[model samples]
Target: MQIRCNQVVCLFALVTALAFLSAACSGEAGSLAAFLTPEGRQPEPTQTLAPTLEGEPAAPAAGTAQAALQAAVEALQGTPTEETVAAAGGRFPATPTAPLLTEGPSVTVTPGSGRANAWVTVTGSGFPANVRVDVYLAGLVSASALAAAPRSYATTFTDRDGNYSMSFAMPSTWPDGTPIETGTLAVLVATEDFGFRANTSFDFVAETATPTQVPPATLTLTPNPTATPVPTAMPTAPRPTAIPPPAVNPYAEVTPLSGGRNAQVTLRGGGFPGHSVIHVYLGTFDAQVGGGERVRYGSAVTESNGNFTISFTLPATWPDGTPVAPGRLLILVATEDLSRQASAVFDYVVPTPTPALNPYAEVQPPSGSANTQVTIRGGGFPANTRVHLYLAGLVSVSAAEAAPTSYASTTTDSAGNYSLTFVMPRTWPDGEAIESGTLALLVATEDFRVRANATFDFVAPTPTAVSGQSWQGSYYANPDLRGDPVLVRADAEIHFYWGTGSPDPALPNDEFSVRWQRSLWFESGLYRFTVEVDDGVRLFVDGNLLLESWRRGERRVLSLDYPMQAGQHTVQLDYFEHAGDALIILNWHRLSDLAPPPTGTPGAPGLLFSNHPWNNQRGVNQTFCSGFESECNYAGCVRNYRLVWGPYCREGDYPYIRPGLYRVTFYGIGRVRAGATDYGSSRQLFSFGQHEFELPGSFTFCWPGRQSDGYGFETIAQSTGVYAAIDWITVEYLGEQCR
Candidate 1:
């Protein structure tokens, strides 16, 4: 089989050699067909050979047979085959290598441009020397190339380094059948050696041209260019001119001098740095100019700065009088050019020969109370002014007659300011609720005729009920009066509610109630009580009479403490009016011993008392047992009796006591026997003591009655030892004892 292969190879070479010779000689393109023919001729049709064992077909190995067949076919067709070579030689074909594909700087094309050029540099590696590159146009190339044609260029060898660059100009002309548009131009680089090929595209566009036109230029020249000639009209030199100065203003103001005899006039508002003069005018009434009477005073000239002032004295013998009527003084200032003018009229009134007095005064209380110290302050009076304050109505000097109404008075000071203050009387027979009244003040001065008679309103205070008491409990009967009675009845109680009923945990214990009550026959005429009860309450006097109660369903009272007296009283209390009930009561007696005792005999128990000889003795010996006691006796028991001072005492001076279960009694006698002598007397017996006193925190008292003349009674024997401090007292009724 080896020998046969060698013979076949030799035969193939001979045939190929013959075909090439034949083609060269014939010089005909058709003669090259001989190379494509099979190599050996066939035997006669009759000489058939039997199949040999070696010739029988075995299953072809995978890949080996196909690869062998491909190689055989390429060799027969004279196509180039890939091969590995150790070195390069002159026999190697010179093929153009593929260029490195990359982007370049972008070029912008205007809409009307017919062509655009992109300088794409082609670089190659592993390329043969002096290679001829055939550039083929990729059909899907950019519109720039489609509207143009494919272009070609040649490049030289890159020496031993095997690198070269060539630039090609892509034409803007398109192939005959291709349309002009925007597209990509794909390029392929290839060579005969099959060693170089690159597939890539570049972007470009094709655009149409716009229409435009340009105008031609023209020229002109002077007729004679040789000699310079003078023109007929020469520019006239501008004549030098001067500007006039601005106009000046003319106006004046006239003011009266100290005594009105001379007038000072001032000129204002004139244009400076200009020659201008002001003219004075005195004209009569002119109907043609305008209606109205006219009188002129005088005018003056202005300075360069446009200001001038002058003093003009009026004629001593003018029309009206020595001082002149406050009219007919008219002044006018007019410019010399008569372009502007200003006028002023002055009317001066002389001061009166005698001054009048101002009528005004104010009454102020020193301590701001009904029994307040009042001060009368005023002005507009001459020196030695005497002012008298009287009751709103009556005018009298004696305290007895003026006791109902009287005020302090004082002489005016140098500055005419006067002030007088005095103790305000307690009673006002004209009525405490006075609306308006008069205060007479007499003024004596040489030139000023001033009389003092001031009428003013005696503003009364508005009454307000205090806390802790109900509507009918202790309240201000007359709030306007400084000493207005704070009337409170026994068994009467007041209720107060506090705090909002908000459902907040933080304010859980906020709501509370307060109660106020008055005691029956309480020592002090006025009584009050307070409690921290949060509901409605009903107050009862004498344990039965309903003095006061809260009808509202809300908790109105929060906390209060008031005064009380010595009587039967009951308080039905509730807290949070709608929640729980609570109450307090104020009970007191006006004539109780709770009042301050009067200053007198060490052990006496009445407001007023007398001390005389025990035996009615004119001397230590020879004494009458019972007779009119010496009015001048200094030390000796005469007789002591009890009397009622009043219904109640002032509440302000006493301390408040709590109420619980208490035992009370009166201990005093109206008549007394001393040293075998019986004497009848009038005295006051008053006393108070705490029994099981139980009260909540925060309580106080308010009592009624005058503070000055209130007293209480105490036993002389029991109270004599240590300045008469009584813990308890007893009262005994004397039926017809001395009477």
Candidate 2:
């Protein structure tokens, strides 16, 4: 039997073989002739054919590929674990997931006839936009092969219209030779989110077979004088033009990104000209902001495999996160030569919830100002036991305490009630804004990931002149305010901008203070005042000390929000420099200056984060580097930081969601450095927003309410100096939850 094993059955899975074997053994066998039919006849779809008596083929088990793959894997190595999966770049999973889609997507070809590896323009619709799909080619003896066997290759995604069209060269791996008379190209889309999956197929015209050649006739003996053999010219077809290879479209993913600032996001994608530089731009969704408005974060060069990954600190240029940040920002990645481009959206901030943190916690009176008391209550908690409180950002209900983050801490009452007064942290550890977008208040109890959180109002007051006026500068002789400075200067409504230079020329290089005194007016509402300082600094409003810090060679900030009347108030900023260099920056803002608020309120912090030794230790789990293992392990270096994302409360603690105003505070010990100078001894300094405590330090996230059965929490503490760590995160709860 002329069995076309190489072409006629290029992709026969064991399914067809086993079925044929069973029927043959059961006295109802179909002959191998079913598949080895003559050139003209078509075979039935259900008819199965056995391999030749030579040997069985290496056909993969189709209907049970998952189970078969599992058994083979176990026999060879061992069991699969999460660690192995994560290290595999999330591309492959040991276990097969659910089916992609029930109704398969379809593909159509333009001018369908083409030779092997020729460019064919295929259009696809009815698929989700901006998502990836796999494209490939396969061949068989007849069109019936479409239902029997298949394979896939190259990956792509759809456009905003859920449509995609590309002129792609056929994959070189396509089967050839005799039995593979017909072929088809296919597109495959699959994802874990929302169970999205689809496959589209289109047939390609078959190529003409080679003509048989004839040998010269033995006519020498019959050749007579009168019949001299006439020579004839053979006909030759013209050569066809060669086609170029298909260019790969760019594709990438940015990790730990939420369209927010201070985060170091990673963009990873491939399929470009190898080793080429890519010009990337962050612009409005499907819109490009021109000239100055355009912010190019950085550039990346593709590796030899057309894949490149670069890390960058997310810029605060788009102050608001996600929706409000001029809608969604489209990240356009293009080649350096200004040739090809590929783009993706920020649709995914966090990964799909693992069916664990659904039904998030909710709180009343979600947003408010400092010292404002609120309630944190949620279900899924046992009654009558104490539960630990942890603060975090972007509350997604999970089963762990959000630690190794800037969330402050507290404890709930026996009835699962905890009251707290709001106190904004002076030392916000995270580089991202505590109030990115509207704010998502995430609250979680100890040993439980379920968090209850709420938002408070920005409460913008009437318009007021936000500029500082009647400014005065003075220098002190001693680091201690023992006497008045030697030199002084003053400016009416001054706009002073300086570097690490000295404030006064007459004063010495170290232990000098430059205080700016002015009278500022405000509308009848809340206003935020921010000051950036180096070394020791202090601020007083209306003769009341609003913030203070005493440190040397450290950059710190003191930010505060308070209510004020329509009249002018006295503002005094006390600043001092010790040794090295110094810098001071100040600013103010109100809520009305922002764009319209987002529709959905954001997360809030009702958890805690600190280096405080809990359970007779610092963290339930200890990490050497930046605490965030994902980034640290990837970079292959351990930074000077420790982290915790928690279930801090032990079981049976029964942490109650109490009611109160809450705030953030932190303290740590580390060595300080002077600007371009070395300080011989250790110095102490304190800071809030624009000030820092050189020796001891403190910070907090805007606190949040408590909840149950959902929200996940995270925390981190880092230092640039010679090893700095936060001591404790405490949220001052000030309300009644008893009864």
Candidate 3:
């Protein structure tokens, strides 16, 4: 059987060879004899072979398609025999070495030529699959021009086959700011990063002119596997029909001609009493200058030329205070004596009811710490109605619906637009500090019937400083950093010249402030930092203030030279622009590699630290309690006599305190513990006083220069249950005590 199959395969190979030779030699295209046998008989139809014995290897059926194809491949390689055919189990595998295929990106624009604002369809193929691709229209078809081309304002995502289609109106100008005219422009489709791009051309013609015959411009399209097809005939856009305007009345006319109640309208007419007051009224033509007056809208004085124009809101009530029903009302323009009267018909139809929409609100910044002045805006509610805003958790809609007192209330405008600003509460309703990065709900509603919610992200209050080579800059709209930053970004340097321009659109050119901070590493050396400012600037290094000029000073230069250790250090600069020319430039240079002494008579004596009872204070582990019985006034304390007791944690007047012991004095009526601590804990605690008596004490600790920014002296009452009052405390620089 194998021998018979092998013979049949050889015969098939011979026949195929003969057929190819005859066709090539004779130049006959597709011949019917190509599938015929040697005797000119039609070939037999193919059929599946039957199964053979289980133990024995079955031979392929004679004259089968598989046998003949196997015979052809083997013959092309070398030869085929009965033993080889039987060993192969009558079937051979398909060719493994097939050609690899690939494709490149391409784009096309429909109705390739058009004027500005003409809608055009753009189709792209072979783009990055399932990714957003931007389409742009350029004045020039060059790589250099694409960078500045105006976008087509269309974006689309490619399908799995990397094809997308979108449409956008054509722009008027090109990349060079020139008007697109009588020339071919490039249409570009590219990813956001411009990693992949394709370009085609568009002919821009004048609006009233026809597109003349022109040569196709060169396109920047990638090669694809298949050849792109060209359209034989281009499509023409249909001309838009022009509509005739409504005829205007010769004697008098209203600009809009018709509107609902309260709608503003402008009436213009000639031949009215000049230099005279014109009383406007909404009524019928017969009612004007006759039986009585009608609904009198305000009056206006006419010009000297006897031509008058009056703008007023449509009245909704008559002169007798009765409601004016919706109908066609005439606006009568006449003098007080009814001498010159002109009338124009105004159709006061019923206002079309607005379609219902789901109410929604959004908060600017979307996330912030406590006291962040959140601006909430709402829409799609009842107009001229109050909307209550609440801060709720993400428990459920039911939980938010049951909130008691609203955080704030604001009324929507006549167009159903609501907006309000409120300070975010420091804690939740349950008196818990709002956790950082927690999701909170901000609901806006009118009696809960029309309610909408938005998510507010609660971030930590204190900004965590990060280490970088550049400055992390924050810009605020106000001089004081009281609200969310207008702009937060990384700045490579602290040089700016915002003479009449602002750092950000949200901030004003004047009265704006900025804070830039960065942790930088440096080698042990003495560095000189210089700053030239128009207004004021404060520089701090590792919490130690090196320069302080927090005032409105004209352009001035300040420099400070300090020795720094070989490690990481933080630098911060705060500047404000009050008015006029604004500019600030900060720079630092290592003066020398030599390290200076830690302590010495570097400068003249100056007051270092003083604590005020009513100044800005932070509480730790306890809340402050105010009492009328305790006193607050002292020589170095706030003038107010109110008393508050808690952790009297006050930052000293100096952040980077020099190495000095100096003198520490405490005058207060309370038990107090004072020392220099990192946070609120001190190893060398100086305890003094009894709760029932006034304690005046003084003590000094070894002065050790701080290497970082936050180490400072702090004081806390021994117990909050007792009367612990801090009247005055001062730290004076006695001399170089550490060295």
Candidate 4:
């Protein structure tokens, strides 16, 4: 395998101090050694260490080591100094021998990709029968084929047929943060103890794929007695054989898929025709593979035993030099004649997690009642990995349900707990909400390992009935210290914004008064009452005068918060209007939502009344007309004629009060017929009220309840009969002030 030249240069630089250690160990630095290693004795170099792979951080080169050695050698000659001796950051080869087998009885790994702490089956056959086989796993740094001396992981004797199999869990790390991706499966089969040992090796690296079906065919291998001593080369020609089909078929295996670039991986499988030329395909397997998403990795010939193992270096690019990125790579093996095939997968990139995560999970309010929201918080789970949660009754019968399928899944957050929340249903999917009891909730990673659980009792939510009582409205024909009402009816709420419509068709719309009151339920907490009214209005809670705007032609509102106790209380509203549009809106809230929001932006929770339509743009100078309510046609253009209305229009501002329902009532004259003017047509005794927009212009609110444009509502001609009149303007706050 070829390593980038740049890496070679860096590796040597980091190992310059190694020279001092070597020379001092030979007694060459008896006195100058203190200068070479000021802090402590320099350490010796390690043999069989992982070589830096293609994509690793650059290490200093042999040239760097030579230069540092030269500098140290000169310093020890007479001008010795710590600076000259100390240098930081490789293996220099002493000799090279050709690998024993170009084609050998090789190792095949069941799983090509996995986390460091996963077990894989290593199996190979056709070695010296009954011989001792020493197996080990070691990662390759520079290139899988370059150099390696892995530590022994297992020892076993081959069966009389010269076949051996062992399962080994991969170690979780490599030195210097080097990823554990590419490695060699080194097998030493010795004729006797410490005697001549014939070595058979194969390389592998992490690389992905799924099985894509191909035309079916079978492989049959006839072992050749001449293929002896295990590592000797056999015939490379193609030969077909007729044989009985074996009970077990052939399977493909590639090792060490969690690797980076330019490493080697070996492909091994059995039960192929003797001397068959097998083809290999690596990359995305397309249904129409001949055209795209696939490129041939190359081919190999099966030995006489129908078993074949071959090693090849990974390329940094496709056949066309399209750079191979860190992702998935498919491995496919087939007969050159297209008579047989098998496939496997390797996830090319073994990415390091951003945060070194640990496992922790918890369900808040572990013992909450049922039908309420419960949050399951977890921290340090594998980032981006899917997590599944299972709910089950804690009983011996629940064991079968522990199967991986019995759960719901969600992805984990990056670098933190995988937070999951859900409301327990009134009953379990099993239809059991045992009158009162607890159920077990378990959480496991998507792969279904490492489970954590908690138990909490719960109950079903029950419905409550509404109090049938509502507002009772009364009407009077004239604006005065009123007598008995002309009309009376049951009103659910005090939100009367009707214009021109009389409390009764029998009563007149103009010059009228209305009163409404009801009993309501309240919780013990801060409460607020918001009322929008026109003309004159007064409000009383439990007979206490909370707010009043008892003046004719006045348009205003009431808003504020007050403490309240849990119980039923009476609310009453008295309203009267001399003429024009009339409206009233009442609403109540609790706690922080009590105060009129910082700035009035319409549609805010506290918004009692706003004449302007919501067009998104608010608070800012309403210069551009993005098609406001009336002038919507000139959208996207600037219209200095702003359409916003202040709470203090021609009318006064809204009345400030506490959080509670207020009785709101309004009175207005009906619209005049077209072409008619004022309360009565000119030279005529009969006239009708005017529309609110036709009555006067509204302005934006100023500080302390004044129109930002100028004084009160722009004066206009009056109408004798009833019609509409805006009670107030609004820029109800969104929550807080935009400014």
lDDT of 4: 0.47
Best by TM-score: 3
Report residue 400 deviation for candidate 3 (angstroms). 12
lDDT by residue (tens digit), candidate 2, 604-670: 2233223342211112111100111111211122343232112122111122222233333444455
lDDT for each of the candidates?
0.33, 0.42, 0.56, 0.47
Ranking by lDDT: 3, 4, 2, 1
Put down candidate 4 lDDT per residue, 279-311, tens digits, no spaces: 666533111112223345667788886788867
State residue 326's C-alpha deviation in candidate 1, in Å: 13
Q: Candidate 2: which stretches are off by over 4 Å?
A: 1-469, 493-501, 556-558, 592-739
Say which prediction, candidate 2 or candidate 3, comes out ahead on TM-score. 3
Off by over 4 Å in 3: 1-358, 362-378, 385-390, 396-411, 418-450, 456-465, 593-739
TM-score of each: 0.23, 0.22, 0.33, 0.22
What's the distance in Å from true for residue 95, model 4?
46
Candidate 4 similarity to native, TM-score: 0.22
Locate the minimum summed-lDDT window of 10 residues in model 2: 673-682
